[model samples]
Every structure is written in structure tokens, then in C-alpha cells.
Target: MRTFVAGQEAVDETEFVELALGIDVDLFRGPLEKETAEERRARRDVAREVLRELRESAEAGDEVAGWDALYADALMRTVPFVRAARGQRAGTGVAA
Candidate 1:
């Protein structure tokens, strides 16, 4: 049996597997195609850990003069995404 995947773009692992495995396309679905609930949870957990460290470092006050602002901005951006991830399954866009 012959299989064809059409595109001028570079084929990634997912497309390669699809062609090789006889097109069980779902064999490779992750942060690229769809973000699963487990993936979301893991991402959120890592964010939480990073935030914790950021808070600690900010309290320490030994970094540059603008790191606090960056941390705050990251927190603000992360909040909404984390909240969205908390909702139903993420069959959505690239991010949350």
C-alpha cells in the first residue's frame, strides 16, 4: 500500500509516523496538534513552580532593576492561560 502526504513544508515526526504506521495519525498528538489535559496540568504545574521561585528571587532583591516587572508581566500572562487550561479539554489554539 502507498501513502502520500501533501505539502511543500518539512515533514515532522507526526507526519512521518502517519506515513510509516499506515496512517494512524493520532499516534503522535501533543503540544503540536492538540494539548491534552495532562499536558495542560503539567504545564501549569511547571508555571507554578517557576512563579514560586520568581517570588522568592524578587523578595531577595538582588537581580537587575527590571526583573520584577518582567516577573509581574509573566504572572499576568500566565494567569489567564492557566485559568483557561483549567477549563474543559484544550482542543483550542497553539496555547491555552
Candidate 2:
């Protein structure tokens, strides 16, 4: 697989090279950075608000119209995670 370094220009996936003999490579994906306390609180707040909305919608028999809102809420919860994973995958590099 191709190698990368943080802050470098992006490269096409087809251009990745297989590792050579004796090379050391580490692969990491997902959230590589830690969230600050304030960010953590914000995420929790969003989650709680979404769950509350979902419960209210369920109680109101509004399931049909609730999915879109729930999906949007889910996206709000995960977009940062997806972005972080992409950044980590693109930024991590071989040390060999």
C-alpha cells in the first residue's frame, strides 16, 4: 500500500506502492485525536437532544416522519468520526 505523511498533498490511491522488504509500516484508522472536554460535552449534549426527540416522536406515533430527523441526528453524531478516520488513514505513514 502507498505511504503518506500528515500535512502532505493528497495522492491518488492507484499510485500507492507495495512495501519493500524490511519495511515497517503501521496502519491506523478511526478517531486518532482526542476530543477536548468541551467538545465531549457538546457531543453528549447532541446525543441527549437527539434521543429525547426520538422518544417524543415515537410517543406521538410519528415514526414515518421521524427517520429523516433521526438520520440527520446520526450524521451529526458521526460526521466528525468519519472525517477523522479519513484524515488518519490519509495522514499516517511508513517509518521504514
Candidate 3:
């Protein structure tokens, strides 16, 4: 894909954000493309871990600047897509 900026052509980078949000990874498969129990469990695990770490850091009075710095560093090395192994039945279509 391509985009124009100031009348100059540029590579379109919109997909990167979707990858960061894991939208580019297909977590569901099989003939029906339905999410399975294992996928739901793994998502729950990740959510719990993230929440636990955030709560712990907040309770410890960690400085937001410090956390932001670390997060930024991690983002710098972020992969386009990080997904579970293939052939694993996963994904829960849950919403916030």
C-alpha cells in the first residue's frame, strides 16, 4: 500500500498499529473458524498477568516516568506479529 504526503509518495504503515494490537494475527482456525477453549484461556492468562504487574507497580509507588521508559524500550523491539503456535484452537471474541 502507498500514501501521499506533501505530494510525495510514501509507504503506507497503517498495518503496523493493527499488528501491535494483534489484529493481524488470526487466532481462530478450522473449517468453521470458531474460537476454542484453549485460546480463551491463554488470553485470560495474559490479561491477568498484565493486570497483576500493573497493580503491583502502582502499589509499590513506582514512578510513571520509569515505567513509561521501560515500555517505550520494549516497543522499540516489538515484532509485527507475536502469536501462538499454529494448529492450536484459540481465541475468545470478548469485548471490553
Candidate 4:
């Protein structure tokens, strides 16, 4: 681990060593578990449903009124999983 301090502030060697040791301890922690199959399926289903609704609305011209009707719909559907994955990645320092 690298320690960075403002130019005006100086850290002693012992403090720097402690900081590096802490970082090393954290780095060796186990990776996070992947999402379960059920969770993946559920999220996919939600995204599919949202896409279907968007398609229907577009077909019916309901989306023609400058409506952001489907705005972020797909993203919203996957937000939970995305957030979980992000948390896992950040915590474990591993890609999900």
C-alpha cells in the first residue's frame, strides 16, 4: 500500500508501516460470493418485463409525447443487482 500525505504534514516511518500493514490485512480478505442463480433469474425477468412494456408502449405510440416513460426503466430493473455487485467488488476488491 502507498501512503499519501499533504506536503505540510509528515508521517513517521512507524505510522506509514502501520498503514501499509492495515492495507495488507484488508487486501488478503476473502472475495465476495457471486449472486445466486435465483437472484440472477429474477433480475433478468424484471428487465425482460420492463423491455416488453417499453416495446408495447412504443408500438402503441404512447411514448411519442416526449415522455421519458421508459427512461432508466432497464437500469432501474437491474439497480439492485448492480448495487450488490458494486458493493461486493468494492469490499472484496474483486470483480463480480
Top candidate when judged by TM-score against the true structure: 1
Residue 34, candidate 2: Cα error in Å is 10
**On residues 1-96, what C-alpha lDDT tens digit does candidate 2 reach at each position?**
546544333364322321221111111111335654476567556656655766587678877436535554454444355556555333255622
Error of 1 at 25 (Å): 28
Clash count, one per candidate:
0, 0, 2, 0
RMSD of each: 14.0, 16.4, 12.0, 17.1
TM-score of each: 0.37, 0.34, 0.32, 0.34
TM-score, ranked from best to worst: 1, 2, 4, 3
Show model 3 residue runs off by greater than 4 Å.
1-34, 63-96
lDDT of 4 at 39: 65
Q: Residue 26 deviation, candidate 4, in Å?
A: 30
Candidate 4, pairs of clashing residues: none
Candidate 1 or 3, higher TM-score?
1
What tens digits encode model 4's per-residue C-alpha lDDT throughout 1-96? 445543223266645643443221111222134565576567556655655665677778865311322443433433344446566433355433
Q: How would you encode candidate 1's per-residue C-alpha lDDT over 1-96 as one tens digit per residue? A: 334555423257656654443322222122334455687577556655555665576677846313643544444343244435655334454565
**Per-residue lDDT over 2-46 for candidate 3, one digit per residue giving the tens place of the 0 to 100 score:** 555545554445444333433222221112243456865675455
Give the whole-model CA lDDT for all candidates, comma-separated. 0.46, 0.44, 0.42, 0.43
In candidate 1, the residue pairs with backbone N, CA or C atoms under 3 Å apart (3 or more residues apart, or in different chains) clash, namely none
lDDT of 3 at 61: 83
